[model samples]
Each structure stands twice: as C-alpha cells, then as structure tokens.
Target: MLKLELPAKYEALRQRVRAFVDELLIPIENASTAGTDLKPEIRARLEDEAKKRDLWMLHVPPEFGGQAGDMFSKIVIWQELGRSIAIPPRRWAVFGPDPGPILYQLAEHQREKYLWPVLRGEKKVAFAQTEPGAGADPAGMSTTAVRDGDHYVINGRKRFIGFGDEADFIQVVALTDPAKRARGGISSFLVDTDTPGFRVVRQLETMMIDRPVELEFVNVRVPAENLIGREGDGFRLAQSWITEGRLARHGARGAGVIERCLELGVAYANERTTFGSKLADRQSIQFMLVDMYQHLYQLRLMLYDTARRFDAGEDIRTESYLCKYFGDESAFHAADRCMQIHGAIGLTTDYPIETFWKQARSFVITEGPTEVMKMVVARKVFEDFTKTA
Candidate 1:
C-alpha cells in the first residue's frame, strides 16, 4: 500500500509555504519581478524572509547547511511556489541556493571544489547536455571527449544551456565512445568555464523569459580527476538528475499553474458580468472552471503518489515520465482555458495568465517533450502488457 495523502507535518509545511507565496511572492510578482531574475535588493529581502520563515535551503542536505527535506516536502514547497508567477519558472532560487541534484553525486574532493562552492553561493554551475543535433536524443550527440595522457580533450557544441554564460563551471556530457554513445560511451565532466578552449558562443532568446546559451568546447582539456563517477556513468547520472527534475520542476510546478489558474478563473467568472448574468452562471464558463479543477486534482494526485513512491526507494522513473507529460499538457490546457475565460485581459500582462500560458506551453516542448515522454511510456506499456498476453 502507498500513501497519497501528505502527512500532518507536510500539510502544515505546505500551508506555511502557501502563506509565504501569497503574502510575499504574489504581491510583488507583477511589479518586482518582470524579468527572469529578481532585482538584487528584492532578492536579498526575500532571502532574509525565507530564512526567517525556515524556508531556506529546503532542498539541500542538513550536513550541507540545508534543511535536508524529503521529496514530498520539497514538492509541497515547489507546488506552492508555482502559485505565483513572481518566481521565475526557469529559476527558483529565492529560498536558498540551488546546487542541483547532480552535484550531490560528486565525490568528496569534487564536492569540496564544486558542490560546496555552489551550496555556499560562492560559485555557479550549469549542465551542458543538449547539443544542436541532439536536443532530445542523447544517442545522437556529436560532442566527443578523447582521453589524453592525464586529461580528456573535449570538443563539442552545446545549445539551449541555461546560465551557460554566467556559470563558473559546467557539468558537461559528451560521447567518449561513439560506438557506445548513451550506452557506455558517454561521460560527464566538471569543466571550468575559463578552460582554454571553452567559450560561450551566444545566448539564444526565446518566447519564454529564459535566455539559454550556446557553447563551444574545442580541445578543452579537463583533468581526469574532474570526471564525475566512472567513465560510463554519464548517461545514468544525467537520467537520475532528469528524473527528479521532471518530478519537481514539471510535475510539482505544473500543479501550481493549475491551482493558480483555477483560482483566477473562478474568481473572474463569479465577479464579471456579461449582458445580464455573471460568467460563473454560464455553462461554458462553469465548464472551463470545472476542467481546470479537474486537471489540478488529477495532477496533484499523480505528483503526490509519484513523490511518495519515490521516497520509498522504489524505481519510479516511468511514473516521473507520466507526471512530466500529463502535468505539462494539463497545465498548458488549464492556462489556455483560463486565458479564454479572462477574455482580453488574459492576453495582456495585467494578469499573470499570459506568463503562465507562455511558460506552461514551453514545458510541453522542453525537458524531454511530451512526444518523447509518451514514447517512453508506450515502450513500458507494451513491455508490461504484451508479455502478460
């Protein structure tokens, strides 16, 4: 048996985070945070508030000066934070440092050099995996890492990497063996951004607020010691990072979008009048609200159930894929309906609906798109059911 309901403590934590977002985040979302990043002074104040509220470093481990929260608790925080567009969809670092999950896999020395600096906010890092020719398919990666006497000479081009230009170092994934590719040929390395041949080519602007970058690594020699885990561990490690990301970033955040959209849609429907009646009284408007509510409820259930099973030390990778596609589609559809319900205001920046709409739409395409996710799930479906038949 699995538990889907959040425990008492987690429920209480959710309410606290919800209050923090409602009081501090939502109030300043439109005014204080217009861009992808919060202003310096505003970020300082919010970090101070987060510390006071015990919301600081909720994801990092306790030994690393963080609260060391479980997946479920972290999801609770993520879902509530999603309620406000004030927190940028791409960058959610208000509470504390976000060193990312990959760093936690680092060895002791690697942690001292990379992970610790990141947790202490002394350094910033970015993951470089998506190549121009291999956005969704890692097996088609053209980037190659050739092992030399004591270093690996990397030659590759990566695109759509967030914070690539600003990062002090990067977690780079490359093909070490063309024959193995994503199987056993791939490897991940911690490369200093200033390494001789590493360059930030340019930043690509998107409809979304995030401006991801393109990078080139030509004969960039990284010390063999910088290799994360074993040589062939790159694909496995990247999958681990992505699985959790799909859970928290897509699954939990999408829930936040649905919850917020439902709130906005219902309020507007009840308040706005057209002709001789409130929009809430009309069946069409009511149906939209109902759909939003339905998506919210279903997403929350999937998110909670997946998080619960994940916390139990079970392999929930497939479930994470389900959460990714379903959450992305459901959230996008909910945003669409919310915008439709808002009439013209939804298209304007007056409400957060437009922001939600654009960001939610992007989720369906990025981070293993809906089609790829469905393909993975379809493989599992055939494997599990066809064998039984």
Candidate 2:
C-alpha cells in the first residue's frame, strides 16, 4: 500500500521548518544576497539560529556531525526552504557543508583526503560532467581520461559547473574507455583545483543570477587512486547523483514553489481590487489559482510517493523523471500565473514573485529538460503498458 500522508513526526517537523521559513527566511526574502549566497553576517546569524533550533546539518550523516536526516525529512525541509528566494536555489551552505552523496562512494584513502575535509568545511568540491556537446546525455561526452602507470591524464572542458571556481577539488567525469562510453567506459576522478592543467575558463552568466563556471582540463593527471569506484562507474555514479537531485531538489522544491505561488496568489487576489471587484472575484484569476492549487496537490502526492519508495531502497529512475519534469513545469506555470495576478508589482523587487518566476522558469531547462524527462517516461510507459498488450 502506498501512503501519501507523512508520518506524525515528519508532519511535525514540516511545521517546524515552515515556521522557520515564514518567520526567519520570508522576512528577509527581499534582502540582497552575496553572489548567490547569503551575506556573511546574515549567514552567521541564521546558522546560529538554526543550531539553536537544532535545524543545522539537516542532510549530513550522523557520523559526520549531522542529523542523518532521512529522504522524506530532507524533502520536507527542502520544500519549506523553497518558499523563500533568500536562499539561493542552487548554492546554499548555511545548513552546513553538503559534500553530496557522490563523495560517499570514494575509496577509504580518498574519503580521508576529500570527503573528510569537506565534512569539516575545510574543503569544497564541484562536480564536472557537462560539456559543450553533452548536457543531458553522457554517451556523447568528448572528455577523455587516458590511463598511465600511476595516473590518468584527463583532457576535457566542462561547462555550467556550479561553484567550480570556489571548490578545493573536482569530481571530474571523463571517458576512460571510448568504446563503452556511458555504457561502461566512463570514469569519475577527483582532481585538485591547483592541479597543473586544471583551469576555470570563465563564469557563465545566467538569468537565474547564479554564475556557474566553465572549466578546462588539459593533460590533468589525477592519481590513479583518485578514481571513485571502478573505472567504468562514472556515468552511473553521476546519474545516481542527478537522479536524487531531481527528486529532492526539483520535485520537492517544485511542490514548495507551487504552495508559495498559491499563497501569494490567493492573498493578493482576495485583497487586490481590479477594474471593479477583488481579483479573487474574477473567474480568470480564480482559474489560475485553481490551476496552481491543482499542481500543488498532484505534485505533493507524487513527490511523497516517490520519495517514500526511494527511502525503501526501490529503484525510481523512471519515476524520478516523471517527478522532475512535472514538478518543474508545474512550478513554472504556477509562478507565471501568480506573476500575472500580481500585475506590474510582480515584476518589481517589491515582491518575490518575479524571482520565483525566473527561478522556476530556469528549472524547466536545467536539471533535466521537460522534453527529455517526458521522453524517458514515455519509454517506460511503452515498456510497462505494452507488456500487457
């Protein structure tokens, strides 16, 4: 049986998180952030506040001085955090260092050198996989890593890597066996930022206000021991990271965005007067609000179900694709409708609607585009449904 409702404890935790966002994050939502991150003073204060509430290190493991939060719990927290634009959608560290799950696959020695430093906030890591020709598909990647006696010489260019300029090391994905490609030829390597041939080419400007960097690796020799897992695990490893991201970041955050849009839209529609009556009184405005509410309801159910299944150790690759595209598209539509309802005020910085609109709009293309997600899901649909035929 599938349970959509959260457990008592989780529901309680969700309330706590929502309260934190409404009281703390929402009030400062309009304040200027420091380059996609919270300002030092603001971050310091919030960190202290979060610690006081025992809200710190929500995603980290218990052994690493974190709460070892579960998947559902993380989705709840992320959903609440999505309500405010004060926290950058992509780069956020106030909750503590999130080395990400891919690092957990590092070998014992690699863990000490890379993962431990990250857990201790002594280091940061950036994942490099996207290239000029590759965005969603890794089979077309052009980056190559040639194995030598003691090291692998990497040559590739990675684009749109978030926080690449500030990282201490990079989890670089390269073609280890050209014949296998994404099937079994790709490999992941940990390369130090100061390594001889590693260079950050430039920061790519984006409408989302987060500047992701482009990186160039020319004959970057990474020690053989730096390879994560086996030589042919790069594509799988990267996809695993991206898969969970679609669920937690895209799916959960989309639910939160829809909820927030509904909140803002309903409040304004009820209060703001139009040509003659309150915006809420207009059928056109009501229809948009209804649509936003419908998306929120559907997305929440799907996110909860998918997250629950994932927590139970189920493989949700196809479900994740469904959640990702539906969530991203829903949130964007909700934001667009909310903006329309708010009229010109929505576009101004006076309201968070504009930022929400922009962020939601960008999500439709970033993680996995809607069309790609739909294509993946369509394949699964045919696989499952045609089996009965």
Model 2 bad stretches (over 4 Å):
1-4, 387-389
lDDT per residue for candidate 2 within 104-165, as digits (tens), equals: 77778888899999987899899888898999776789999999999999998999999999
lDDT for each residue of candidate 1 in 3-63, tens digit (9 for 90 to 100): 3457898888888899999999898877766455887788889999999998889878787
Model 1 steric clash total:
0
Clash count, one per candidate: 0, 0
Model 1, global lDDT: 0.89
Instruction: Mark the 10 consecutive residues where model 2 has the least summed lDDT.
Output: 1-10
